[model samples]
Target: MHWISMIGIALAANLDNLGIGVSFGARSTRVPFISNLVIAILSMIAAYLSITLGMVISQYVPSNYANWGGGALIILIGIYAVISDYKSNSKIQNENGITSYIHSPNKADKDNNKVISWKESLTLGVALALNCVVGGFGAGVTGLSPIMTTLFIGLFSLLTVDIGVRAGQQIAKTLIGKWFNLLGGVLLICIGLYEMFV
Candidate 1:
């Protein structure tokens, strides 16, 4: 029962990663495999760090306070997501006095493209990993052992996110539509608040 609950918690926490991956994949026809791999690696590292920090902090803080802190962090992330989505939707008038919709490339064009730079991959990896940690910390405060829970959460989250990215890449060329990242953001905020206060 404990393991089942832990896995469920991990899955719920990773929904943000899935949503982010979908957004990224929706914006790019080609899923950068190397970038995804880097994301996975960085997520593992962040999960490790978050779990370690949580363990140490749990010793000093009341359990309820720790949970609330985690919940607050998640809420902040949710707000950021909503803001980012809105910004992405805003129209920008180019210096050429023209406005164009941002569109992803076709699959054929992407297949012939060069690999993304390591530096770019690293930056994306770090950002995605940080997101994982914030979500992971919130889920971890439920008394599960951090190390094992972090490992499972990181691994499974990466797997699910990669799947979403790949699927998005395949259809991105044909799916030139806007996604409401704000929906996920709102969901995150509600979940975080419920966890903290309920």
Candidate 2:
């Protein structure tokens, strides 16, 4: 039962990753397989860092307070996600003076041409990892065994996120486009609230 609960928590925490993956997929149609793998690896590293940090901090703070703190942080992240979703939903012209739909299939291809250099990929990887770390802190505060829990959660989360990205890429091939970021942002906010308050 305990293991099940841990896996459940890990799965819930991966919602953000799934959303981010979808956004990445929707934005880049030709995402290399290696790139996806790298993203997953970075996400795992982030989970590790977050869990380790949470464990260390747990020693300094009261358990109850730590839980509440985690909840508060999640709520804040939710609010930020909501705002970002709003901004991302707005229409914007690319450097080529083309007004692209957020859900457009060609948007990813167009964006891909903008030059996703290695430096950018590395930066995006770190960003993705940081996001995972934030959620991992909440998982750590739940009193689960850190390393074991992190491993299971990371693996599952990465798998789901990869699938989401691939699916988004495929779907982007059809319609004018979908607001995957907005959808993901909403999920994050909702999940964060649930974790914090419930």
Candidate 3:
């Protein structure tokens, strides 16, 4: 993948991290620097593996089909994100809960002290990184370098989360967290469509 495309994929892959970060920030939860580092590293690994798998899969199919297939996968992932976000929001409404565990790394408790544990940080990192694997596959099929993609993923994951947390701190009460995922899904779907058509 070209450097520009790698950056795009990385941004899309970690967009959810912004929302997750917002959730953490709104609660005044501290995300340790180490946690950010771990998340970045895990995402890089996931990107490498997914892209390699896509490369392997590309070998078996007609080049045209492979391209469309990659696009289709991205669209499907976007659709899934949109659906999941809607369902999660609805469920939270029904439960009358202040905290949502769906599609987020932050956990809500009755106690005001809401620091995220290191274990939870690792788990969250893994969960968030899973989103990138399929995207890396899409990029891989389109001929992106795994090494460059990994670097982009690591960089974007850290940047997006940091920004999201800060922004969340400013608008935590007013912002609806699900919209972050919703926007990310829309971008993914658009990228997928663009890949298929272009």
Candidate 4:
């Protein structure tokens, strides 16, 4: 429940938002305000749930084990993120004997007409929020305040996405295209590893 812990958890949880924002912003796509709000809300809910789950588990398990478990869970989530992103980025062969790939939210926005619809925003929000759940659970197990964590996460996510989008708009594509998710995943894994040992 320390303020420092809350801040750390929030920042670690939402780093991916910057990447998402940059991806969309680089294409001049606006993530509508409502969508941003929805994303915050969704992130809050997911974080709260994960923390609550941790608290419940804490009641049944020793505090030490709970901490280790939470840390392990977060590490697993980080690995999943990296693997999933790698899979998504790889080309797939379709029935037409052509290679294709899943679209990034920004690319989808562009394909759908250079504007990101509310629904699309919600979908993006959900996807982004997934990154927060594991870290939130770990923070909760280590005695962080779920409410404060959620509040910080929502606020940080909103701000990060906004900043990322703005930065994306200014940055070159070659730079932006590089490795946002990979970096975020590595950060999460490192944080989880730190938590596990400490």
Write down the RMSD of all candidates, one decimal each: 6.5, 5.9, 3.7, 4.3
Pairs that collide in candidate 3 are 1-143, 1-144, 1-145
lDDT rank order: 3, 4, 1, 2
- Give the top-scoring candidate (TM-score): 3
Candidate 3 lDDT tens digits, 48-160 = 99999888878888998877888888788888878977886677543323223424455532234576555556667777778788888987776668888889899999997
Q: Which stretches of candidate 2 lie over 4 Å from their true place?
A: 1-34, 91-123, 142-145, 173-179, 182-198
Cα misplacement distance, residue 100 of candidate 2 (Å): 16
Worst 10 residues of 2 by lDDT: 96-105
**Per-model tally of clashing residue pairs:** 0, 4, 3, 0
Better of 2 and 3 by lDDT: 3
Using lDDT, give the best candidate's number. Answer: 3
Whichever of 3 and 4 has more TM-score, that candidate is 3
Q: List the residue pairs that clash in candidate 1.
A: none
The TM-score ranking, best first, is 3, 4, 2, 1
lDDT of 1 by residue, 1-198 (tens): 246434544554455456545545655533466666665677778877776766676667787787687667667867886887687679643422101111221211333353334445465456556655665665555445676666676676667566666666554455332453566466667766766776
Show model 4 residue runs off by greater than 4 Å: 2-5, 85-103, 107-113, 117-119
lDDT, residue 79, model 1: 86
Local error of candidate 2 at residue 148 (angstroms)? 4.5
lDDT of 4 by residue, 161-189 (tens): 78877888665366654566666666667
Please tell me which model should have the higher TM-score, number 1 or number 4.
4
lDDT of 4 at 4: 57
Candidate 3: list runs displaced more than 4 Å: 1-4, 93-104, 108-120
